[model samples]
Target: VKSLEDFYDMEGFRDKEFDKDDKGTWVVSSKIAIQKDDSSPLVSKNIYLFFNKNNNKATGKFVLSKIYEDFSKNTENEYRIAYSNNKIELLDNAPKEVELFLKDYKFLVEEKSFKSLNNLPKISSRHNDNLPLYSINYLIKQDNEINKWLQQKYKFMKQDAIMNIENSGELSNSSLSNFYFKVRYKGKKEEIQYFRESINFKPSKGGY
Candidate 1:
């Protein structure tokens, strides 16, 4: 198995700039500018990829990180179309073991299905905190009832519920909502975008 250190030292990444995190994980990043003509402005993009040495031998996938666009809004974008088909990069010089962890920082969850490789911590593990449980309840409720229940429960918990906890916007509704909760654990906190099929929600609670 190739270690992360070896990967960084590889030819492709040897010249790239990077930094180490507190956990010893490395973030390899780069900035690139492309220009087709002097008349057309240059297009610049920043690419980031995180590399963490796997502590376990089990194969896993990278958890979804930050998403930048609304695929629901730009359904016809050719880029979106390419990603949707997973025709992007299956033949890249990537390791099968690597396919288990650390998603390509350039791609979004909407572009591909990495569900089989996902290895996020369980949200229910921190039941004593009550926040995650409330979050589940919040996600489970139908109609606008989630707001009232969350408001009263949050007060009892002596804490205010924060929406878009991770700025993921995964928990938003068509209308404004007063009830929102943040899921925090082991000093890590974020409103993760749970898979819709994995959640227990009423299929036809409201008019579709």
Candidate 2:
């Protein structure tokens, strides 16, 4: 999670500027969402500030950087400035005071449920043809080993799960309709349960 002040503090941000159209509406600027390294996972999120020629304050509409892409359109009369990953989205009809208030506000990571299995038996008879009958103690150790392996695998899947949540925009428990864990022995998917928290853009008046 990062704040708008943090965003502005990044190198080259202060120099970024907005471009306007013939009709006086701001055009999407190249300054929006600068990806300097191109190889870096982090990208700059940009908010185009449009203003009246007669007034230094906003004229109304503005354009924001889009999620998963590069651009989105909005108006001050119809939207507020907010961050989502390396992009921005509209917040319906937000006031200037609210926008200013949020200028330094940081985005908090939103948490979602992540599920995988635990306590699975290793070398199940269903899969292994070998009949090396094991003692209860050995079986327990095998189960523990299997669980450890699953945890390692699940860690790799965390990024993908977070990406899915971002793309879908559905954070409800019911919306978590995917699995990343499986048990080879029983041919059954492992049931997992955990929570994922990632920085997400949303309109807020401060407290959770």
**Model 2: how far residue 117 lies from native, Å:** 59
Please name the candidate that would achieve the greatest lDDT relative to the true structure.
2
- lDDT, candidates in the order shown: 0.25, 0.27
Question: RMSD in Å for candidate 2, one decimal?
Answer: 20.9
Candidate 2 Cα misplacement greater than 4 A, ranges:
1-44, 60-78, 81-102, 105-208
TM-score for each model? 0.19, 0.18
Query: What digit string (tens of lDDT, one per residue) describes model 2 on residues 78-186?
Result: 3444344444434666556546533542212111122332332333322122431221111223224333433353322221111112221223532221112222121
lDDT of 1 by residue, 1-208 (tens): 1232332222221112223321122333322233333333333333333333232111112222222243343211111101112222222344453343223423222222323212322333223232223233222211223223333422112232222212111233321111222321111132221111111111111110
